[model samples]
Target: MDTTACTILLVDDEAANLDLLELVLRPRGYGRLVRVADAREAVAAFEAAAPDLVLLDLHMPHRDGLAVLAELQARVPEGDFLPVLVLTADATPAARERALAAGAHDFVTKPFDRLEVLLRARNLLRTRLLHRAQRDARGAAELAAVQGRLLADEW
Candidate 1:
Protein backbone atom coordinates (compact mmCIF):
# COMPACT_ATOMS: atom_id res chain seq x y z
CA MET A 1 0.00 0.00 0.00
CA ASP A 2 1.11 3.53 -0.74
CA THR A 3 1.33 5.22 2.64
CA THR A 4 1.39 8.63 1.05
CA ALA A 5 -2.11 8.10 -0.32
CA CYS A 6 -3.53 7.43 3.12
CA THR A 7 -5.77 10.06 4.69
CA ILE A 8 -5.13 11.12 8.31
CA LEU A 9 -7.61 12.85 10.58
CA LEU A 10 -6.02 15.27 13.07
CA VAL A 11 -8.32 15.84 16.07
CA ASP A 12 -7.02 18.46 18.48
CA ASP A 13 -8.64 21.48 20.06
CA GLU A 14 -5.48 23.50 19.89
CA ALA A 15 -4.47 25.02 16.60
CA ALA A 16 -0.81 24.85 17.56
CA ASN A 17 -0.99 21.13 18.10
CA LEU A 18 -2.72 20.67 14.78
CA ASP A 19 -0.06 22.76 13.12
CA LEU A 20 2.67 20.74 14.73
CA LEU A 21 1.11 17.49 13.63
CA GLU A 22 0.84 18.77 10.06
CA LEU A 23 4.44 19.86 10.22
CA VAL A 24 5.51 16.43 11.37
CA LEU A 25 3.54 14.55 8.76
CA ARG A 26 3.55 16.84 5.73
CA PRO A 27 7.25 16.44 4.97
CA ARG A 28 6.91 12.72 5.24
CA GLY A 29 4.70 12.75 2.07
CA TYR A 30 1.41 12.45 3.93
CA GLY A 31 -0.76 14.49 1.57
CA ARG A 32 -4.32 14.08 2.73
CA LEU A 33 -4.81 15.47 6.26
CA VAL A 34 -8.11 16.58 7.76
CA ARG A 35 -7.81 18.86 10.83
CA VAL A 36 -10.66 19.14 13.32
CA ALA A 37 -10.36 21.45 16.33
CA ASP A 38 -13.65 20.62 17.99
CA ALA A 39 -14.37 17.16 19.28
CA ARG A 40 -17.98 17.66 18.23
CA GLU A 41 -16.92 17.78 14.59
CA ALA A 42 -14.66 14.79 14.87
CA VAL A 43 -17.15 12.13 13.91
CA ALA A 44 -18.45 14.17 11.03
CA ALA A 45 -14.97 14.84 9.82
CA PHE A 46 -14.08 11.22 10.26
CA GLU A 47 -17.08 10.11 8.26
CA ALA A 48 -16.26 12.56 5.52
CA ALA A 49 -12.54 11.87 5.41
CA ALA A 50 -12.59 8.13 6.00
CA PRO A 51 -9.08 8.50 7.29
CA ASP A 52 -6.76 5.54 7.62
CA LEU A 53 -5.31 6.92 10.87
CA VAL A 54 -6.44 9.37 13.57
CA LEU A 55 -4.22 11.46 15.86
CA LEU A 56 -6.48 12.35 18.77
CA ASP A 57 -6.02 14.72 21.70
CA LEU A 58 -7.07 13.36 25.09
CA HIS A 59 -8.33 16.57 26.70
CA MET A 60 -10.84 18.73 24.86
CA PRO A 61 -13.55 21.14 26.00
CA HIS A 62 -16.90 19.91 24.65
CA ARG A 63 -16.00 16.20 24.78
CA ASP A 64 -13.08 14.35 26.29
CA GLY A 65 -10.86 12.12 24.19
CA LEU A 66 -12.25 8.97 25.70
CA ALA A 67 -15.76 10.01 24.80
CA VAL A 68 -14.65 10.75 21.29
CA LEU A 69 -12.96 7.41 21.18
CA ALA A 70 -16.19 5.76 22.23
CA GLU A 71 -18.08 7.59 19.52
CA LEU A 72 -15.48 6.49 17.01
CA GLN A 73 -15.73 2.94 18.20
CA ALA A 74 -19.43 3.02 17.57
CA ARG A 75 -19.02 4.59 14.16
CA VAL A 76 -16.25 2.38 12.84
CA PRO A 77 -17.28 -1.12 11.93
CA GLU A 78 -15.77 -4.07 13.76
CA GLY A 79 -12.55 -5.56 12.30
CA ASP A 80 -11.69 -2.34 10.49
CA PHE A 81 -8.11 -1.31 11.32
CA LEU A 82 -8.47 2.43 11.81
CA PRO A 83 -5.71 3.30 14.25
CA VAL A 84 -6.22 6.05 16.80
CA LEU A 85 -3.06 7.42 18.38
CA VAL A 86 -3.93 9.22 21.61
CA LEU A 87 -1.78 12.35 22.00
CA THR A 88 -2.00 14.12 25.33
CA ALA A 89 0.07 15.73 28.07
CA ASP A 90 -1.56 13.51 30.66
CA ALA A 91 0.95 10.70 31.06
CA THR A 92 -0.79 9.07 34.02
CA PRO A 93 -1.18 5.32 34.04
CA ALA A 94 -4.91 5.66 34.52
CA ALA A 95 -5.23 7.88 31.47
CA ARG A 96 -3.25 5.40 29.41
CA GLU A 97 -5.41 2.56 30.62
CA ARG A 98 -8.59 4.43 29.81
CA ALA A 99 -7.41 5.34 26.33
CA LEU A 100 -6.35 1.80 25.57
CA ALA A 101 -9.61 0.37 26.84
CA ALA A 102 -11.48 2.99 24.83
CA GLY A 103 -9.89 1.58 21.63
CA ALA A 104 -6.76 3.63 21.11
CA HIS A 105 -4.26 1.70 19.01
CA ASP A 106 -1.29 3.62 20.44
CA PHE A 107 -0.70 6.30 23.12
CA VAL A 108 1.76 9.16 22.93
CA THR A 109 2.18 11.75 25.64
CA LYS A 110 2.61 15.40 24.75
CA PRO A 111 5.94 17.09 24.27
CA PHE A 112 6.40 13.90 22.33
CA ASP A 113 9.64 13.02 20.64
CA ARG A 114 9.45 13.80 16.92
CA LEU A 115 11.20 10.62 15.89
CA GLU A 116 9.10 8.44 18.11
CA VAL A 117 5.88 9.96 16.86
CA LEU A 118 6.88 9.36 13.27
CA LEU A 119 7.88 5.78 13.98
CA ARG A 120 4.71 4.99 15.88
CA ALA A 121 2.46 6.52 13.22
CA ARG A 122 4.31 4.63 10.52
CA ASN A 123 3.94 1.35 12.33
CA LEU A 124 0.23 1.81 12.91
CA LEU A 125 -0.35 2.80 9.30
CA ARG A 126 1.55 -0.27 8.15
CA THR A 127 -0.68 -2.52 10.19
CA ARG A 128 -3.81 -0.83 8.94
CA LEU A 129 -2.72 -1.24 5.33
CA LEU A 130 -1.95 -4.89 5.92
CA HIS A 131 -5.34 -5.47 7.48
CA ARG A 132 -7.08 -3.84 4.50
CA ALA A 133 -5.10 -6.00 2.09
CA GLN A 134 -5.99 -9.19 3.92
CA ARG A 135 -9.65 -8.27 4.06
CA ASP A 136 -9.68 -7.55 0.35
CA ALA A 137 -7.98 -10.84 -0.41
CA ARG A 138 -10.52 -12.72 1.68
CA GLY A 139 -13.39 -10.99 -0.07
CA ALA A 140 -11.92 -11.83 -3.46
CA ALA A 141 -11.51 -15.46 -2.51
CA GLU A 142 -15.11 -15.67 -1.31
CA LEU A 143 -16.36 -14.12 -4.52
CA ALA A 144 -14.28 -16.55 -6.58
CA ALA A 145 -15.72 -19.52 -4.72
CA VAL A 146 -19.25 -18.27 -5.27
CA GLN A 147 -18.60 -17.78 -8.96
CA GLY A 148 -17.06 -21.25 -9.25
CA ARG A 149 -20.10 -22.82 -7.60
CA LEU A 150 -22.44 -20.92 -9.91
CA LEU A 151 -20.53 -22.17 -13.00
CA ALA A 152 -20.52 -25.75 -11.72
CA ASP A 153 -24.27 -25.65 -11.17
CA GLU A 154 -24.82 -24.21 -14.68
CA TRP A 155 -22.80 -27.04 -16.26
Candidate 2:
Protein backbone atom coordinates (compact mmCIF):
# COMPACT_ATOMS: atom_id res chain seq x y z
CA MET A 1 0.00 0.00 0.00
CA ASP A 2 1.11 3.52 -0.68
CA THR A 3 2.16 5.46 2.42
CA THR A 4 0.39 8.51 1.15
CA ALA A 5 -2.83 6.57 0.67
CA CYS A 6 -2.83 4.83 4.03
CA THR A 7 -5.17 6.24 6.68
CA ILE A 8 -3.85 6.62 10.24
CA LEU A 9 -5.92 7.27 13.35
CA LEU A 10 -4.33 9.29 16.17
CA VAL A 11 -5.94 8.92 19.59
CA ASP A 12 -4.78 11.31 22.30
CA ASP A 13 -6.55 13.56 24.76
CA GLU A 14 -4.06 16.38 24.29
CA ALA A 15 -4.71 18.61 21.32
CA ALA A 16 -1.06 19.56 21.19
CA ASN A 17 0.06 15.96 20.89
CA LEU A 18 -2.40 15.30 18.10
CA ASP A 19 -1.32 18.47 16.31
CA LEU A 20 2.34 17.61 16.63
CA LEU A 21 1.76 14.17 15.18
CA GLU A 22 -0.20 15.56 12.27
CA LEU A 23 2.49 18.11 11.58
CA VAL A 24 5.17 15.47 11.44
CA LEU A 25 3.19 12.98 9.42
CA ARG A 26 1.58 15.25 6.81
CA PRO A 27 4.85 16.36 5.29
CA ARG A 28 6.17 12.82 5.40
CA GLY A 29 3.59 11.80 2.76
CA TYR A 30 0.89 10.60 5.10
CA GLY A 31 -2.14 12.38 3.72
CA ARG A 32 -5.03 10.63 5.46
CA LEU A 33 -4.95 11.33 9.19
CA VAL A 34 -7.77 11.16 11.73
CA ARG A 35 -7.46 12.72 15.19
CA VAL A 36 -9.60 11.82 18.19
CA ALA A 37 -9.23 13.68 21.50
CA ASP A 38 -11.26 11.35 23.68
CA ALA A 39 -10.65 7.66 24.11
CA ARG A 40 -14.38 7.11 23.83
CA GLU A 41 -14.24 8.46 20.29
CA ALA A 42 -11.35 6.27 19.29
CA VAL A 43 -13.37 3.23 18.36
CA ALA A 44 -15.96 5.26 16.51
CA ALA A 45 -13.27 7.08 14.56
CA PHE A 46 -11.53 3.81 13.88
CA GLU A 47 -14.69 2.20 12.56
CA ALA A 48 -15.43 5.23 10.43
CA ALA A 49 -11.89 5.65 9.13
CA ALA A 50 -10.85 2.00 8.84
CA PRO A 51 -7.32 3.26 9.35
CA ASP A 52 -4.27 1.30 8.27
CA LEU A 53 -2.61 2.05 11.58
CA VAL A 54 -3.51 3.45 15.02
CA LEU A 55 -1.37 5.65 17.28
CA LEU A 56 -2.95 5.30 20.74
CA ASP A 57 -2.17 7.33 23.83
CA LEU A 58 -2.21 5.25 26.98
CA HIS A 59 -3.47 7.97 29.30
CA MET A 60 -6.91 9.34 28.58
CA PRO A 61 -10.01 10.35 30.52
CA HIS A 62 -13.29 8.32 30.67
CA ARG A 63 -11.77 5.28 29.01
CA ASP A 64 -8.09 4.40 29.32
CA GLY A 65 -5.89 3.08 26.52
CA LEU A 66 -6.25 -0.50 27.67
CA ALA A 67 -10.01 -0.27 27.48
CA VAL A 68 -9.78 1.29 24.04
CA LEU A 69 -7.44 -1.46 22.94
CA ALA A 70 -9.92 -4.08 24.07
CA GLU A 71 -12.69 -2.37 22.18
CA LEU A 72 -10.54 -2.21 19.06
CA GLN A 73 -9.66 -5.87 19.35
CA ALA A 74 -13.32 -6.74 19.59
CA ARG A 75 -14.25 -4.53 16.70
CA VAL A 76 -11.73 -6.10 14.31
CA PRO A 77 -12.79 -9.31 12.62
CA GLU A 78 -10.96 -12.49 13.66
CA GLY A 79 -9.04 -12.90 10.38
CA ASP A 80 -8.20 -9.23 9.91
CA PHE A 81 -5.21 -7.43 11.46
CA LEU A 82 -5.04 -3.89 12.85
CA PRO A 83 -1.76 -2.52 14.11
CA VAL A 84 -2.07 -0.54 17.35
CA LEU A 85 0.98 1.39 18.51
CA VAL A 86 0.77 2.52 22.13
CA LEU A 87 2.21 5.93 23.02
CA THR A 88 2.57 6.73 26.70
CA ALA A 89 4.63 8.62 29.26
CA ASP A 90 4.77 5.51 31.37
CA ALA A 91 8.15 3.81 30.77
CA THR A 92 7.79 1.17 33.43
CA PRO A 93 8.33 -2.46 32.51
CA ALA A 94 4.91 -3.31 33.81
CA ALA A 95 3.26 -0.76 31.53
CA ARG A 96 5.09 -2.10 28.50
CA GLU A 97 4.17 -5.65 29.33
CA ARG A 98 0.54 -4.72 29.89
CA ALA A 99 0.26 -2.88 26.60
CA LEU A 100 1.85 -5.72 24.68
CA ALA A 101 -0.37 -8.25 26.38
CA ALA A 102 -3.40 -6.12 25.59
CA GLY A 103 -2.67 -6.32 21.81
CA ALA A 104 -0.44 -3.32 21.09
CA HIS A 105 1.88 -4.04 18.16
CA ASP A 106 4.45 -1.47 19.32
CA PHE A 107 5.12 1.09 22.10
CA VAL A 108 6.58 4.57 22.03
CA THR A 109 7.40 6.53 25.16
CA LYS A 110 6.26 10.10 25.70
CA PRO A 111 8.32 12.93 24.20
CA PHE A 112 8.75 10.60 21.26
CA ASP A 113 11.53 11.14 18.78
CA ARG A 114 10.18 12.31 15.45
CA LEU A 115 12.27 9.97 13.32
CA GLU A 116 11.51 6.97 15.49
CA VAL A 117 7.80 7.63 15.35
CA LEU A 118 7.88 7.89 11.58
CA LEU A 119 9.93 4.73 11.23
CA ARG A 120 7.70 2.73 13.56
CA ALA A 121 4.56 3.96 11.90
CA ARG A 122 5.94 3.06 8.50
CA ASN A 123 6.83 -0.43 9.67
CA LEU A 124 3.41 -1.01 11.16
CA LEU A 125 1.67 0.18 8.01
CA ARG A 126 3.82 -2.12 5.95
CA THR A 127 2.82 -5.01 8.16
CA ARG A 128 -0.83 -4.08 7.79
CA LEU A 129 -0.52 -4.09 4.04
CA LEU A 130 1.09 -7.51 4.06
CA HIS A 131 -1.57 -8.91 6.36
CA ARG A 132 -4.33 -7.57 4.12
CA ALA A 133 -2.72 -9.06 1.02
CA GLN A 134 -2.39 -12.46 2.66
CA ARG A 135 -6.01 -12.42 3.76
CA ASP A 136 -7.14 -11.45 0.30
CA ALA A 137 -5.13 -14.26 -1.23
CA ARG A 138 -6.65 -16.77 1.17
CA GLY A 139 -10.12 -15.59 0.33
CA ALA A 140 -9.47 -15.86 -3.38
CA ALA A 141 -8.11 -19.36 -2.96
CA GLU A 142 -11.19 -20.42 -1.03
CA LEU A 143 -13.47 -19.01 -3.72
CA ALA A 144 -11.50 -20.79 -6.43
CA ALA A 145 -11.75 -24.08 -4.55
CA VAL A 146 -15.51 -23.76 -4.21
CA GLN A 147 -15.84 -23.00 -7.92
CA GLY A 148 -13.65 -25.94 -8.84
CA ARG A 149 -15.75 -28.29 -6.68
CA LEU A 150 -18.95 -27.02 -8.30
CA LEU A 151 -17.53 -27.58 -11.78
CA ALA A 152 -16.48 -31.13 -10.85
CA ASP A 153 -19.96 -31.96 -9.50
CA GLU A 154 -21.58 -30.68 -12.70
CA TRP A 155 -19.28 -32.92 -14.81
Best by lDDT: 2
**TM-score for each prediction?**
0.96, 0.95
**On residues 56-145, what C-alpha lDDT tens digit does candidate 1 reach at each position?**
999999999899888888888877878999999999999999999888999999999988988898889999999999999999999999
lDDT, residue 53, candidate 2: 92
> Residue by residue across 51-147, what tens digits does model 2's lDDT show?
9899999989999999999999999988889999999999999999999999999999989999999999999999999999999999999999999
RMSD (Cα, Å) for all candidates, in order, is: 1.0, 1.1
Worst 10 residues of 1 by lDDT: 72-81
> Which window of 10 residues has the lowest lDDT sum in candidate 2?
1-10
